[model samples]
Target: MEEIIKVEKLTKTYGSRKAVSNMNLSVNRGTAFALLGENGAGKSTAIECILGTKRADSGNVSVLGYDPAADRKTLFEKVGVQFQENNYQEKIIVTELCEVTASLYRKTAEPEYLLEKFGILDKLKSPVEELSGGQKQRLSVVLALLPEPEVVFLDELTTGLDTKARRAVWKTLSELKEKGLTILMTSHFMEEVEALCDEICILKQGETVFYGAVDDAIRNSPCNKLEDAYLWYTDMEGTADENF
Candidate 1:
């Protein structure tokens, strides 16, 4: 497999506290990779370092054969990012947002077509401020894909969606991978990671505690489910009811 991203001994510190310590990982072309951790587990910090949004005290990060920090523009052009936050203007209509976002890329999907695929085509005239939280989230996602990016980063990609919306989003994401897009996402939901990622990296206290196959993670946890595996990997390793 072709290496699209590589990080060697990546470390990020805020004065004496190490947010991410000695991180090492890579993502190959067309693969789905995940960083699974709880809130404050350093997942965002690691991602910021990787994305060049924040500087690491010491480390090397390369995305698509170029240093993300030094070559942010190159990677930015090639990467589609779906951040958990909505950064678009609130007054803009859904269709306007799509059209504006698509204008940034050399190749873009028609705004109407993308909105249709996302099931919000009829809501195009609706202002972002008037949309529901789930609708906004879905729109943010659709804009991210507007660039036709080769690599995508989805942080907390399914935070507030209802079950049906989540399922729809997941199916759409799966098809992106099938079309050979490399995706890396950070999700606290074990089921989301298991269903979407080809491999998982479990972090504990800012360090990698488990990094390998999803099935192995489950078996290693001595459980039949990914959530159980997460609790196991975190050393809580048993039914929540039993623990409680």
Candidate 2:
């Protein structure tokens, strides 16, 4: 498989603390990759460095064959991102927000199509602030897809979704992956990772403890399930479900 995203010796620090230390990972084209870690395990910092939102203290990072820190203008045209939280203008309606977002890209998918596909078309006239948490989450995904990007980064992809909505989003993403869209996502849900990811990198204290197939992770650990394997690898073996 072609390598689409690469990071080598990526490091980031805030004061005396190293948020990401010598991180290295490669994401293949047309495959979904998951970044797994406990809270404050440096996943967010790693992503920021990769996206060039935050400059790394040291290391090389590339996305789509371009240096993200130096070639962001060109690389962003083919990349999309859906953050865990999005803040829209007060009283901004869905259609207005969509139009504004569409104007930023040279070419974009039809807003109505994406909205309906995510089951939020009826909220077109509703103020973004008025939408429910799940509705807002779906809207964020729709906005991210508007650019028809080749690679997308999703932070906590199904955080606010219920079971049915989560499954629906998973199906949509799975289809997109099948159609050759590369996905990089972070989610605490082991089931979601098992369902959507082809490969995974588990981070611990800003370092990669394991990077491989989910089945391999299970085999490597003393646990038979991905969730248990994750707990074992992260050193939270006896923790309860709430930790996830």
Candidate 3:
């Protein structure tokens, strides 16, 4: 696997509060990478720093050989981001939204094809406010894929999705990986993480506790289930992580 994203000793702070510290991550081309951590564990902070929306207090971060903190345009154009929850205009039709997103790419996929891929073509005429939670989530994923981005970022990708819908999305993401698209995702579900990620980066109190292959992380932990392994990894009673 050729490295696509590289970070070295990355750290961030909000005033005196340290959000992330000494975090290093490497994601290979066409691989799916997950960031795993509980709330307020600096998972979002790390992503913000990586996206250049916020700067780290110290350390180095490079996405596609560019500093996200300094050059936003190039990185954003090359990357697609699916937020946990987005506020699309209530009046915008599902089909329109797809078209708008596709227009941003130098060579975008057809909006109709994307809608079909995510099972939302039938909802084309419906307004954003009229769709079910699962439908909305699925629509968002389709929009993210419109540009056929090289790197995609998904934060809590299954937040409002049902089990069946979530599984469907996973299947699509796996297909994207097969096509050599790099994915970086943040998620709370350990099963989702285990199912989707090729490798993982574990954060504790804003610091990296683990960064390696998913199988190895599970094998090193004394747990039978992936969820159990995550608990042992984060030393949690009940918890979550950063996944796309």
* Maximum-lDDT candidate: 2
Highest TM-score: which candidate?
2
The TM-score obtained by model 1 is 0.93
lDDT of each: 0.82, 0.91, 0.83
Question: Which residue pairs collide in model 2, if any?
Answer: none
| Residue 213 C-alpha lDDT in model 2 | 88
Which model is ahead, 2 or 3, in terms of lDDT? 2
Task: Give per-residue CA lDDT, model 2, range 129-216, as digits (tens).
Answer: 8999999999999998899999999999999899999998999889989999999999999999999998999998888899998899
- Residues 170-198 of candidate 1 have per-residue lDDT tens digits of 88888888888899899877778877888
TM-score of 2: 0.95
In model 2, the runs with Cα more than 4 Å from the true position are 236-244
**lDDT tens string, model 3, 108-148?**
77878877877778999999999998888888888888888
RMSD (Cα, Å) for all candidates, in order, is 2.1, 2.3, 3.6
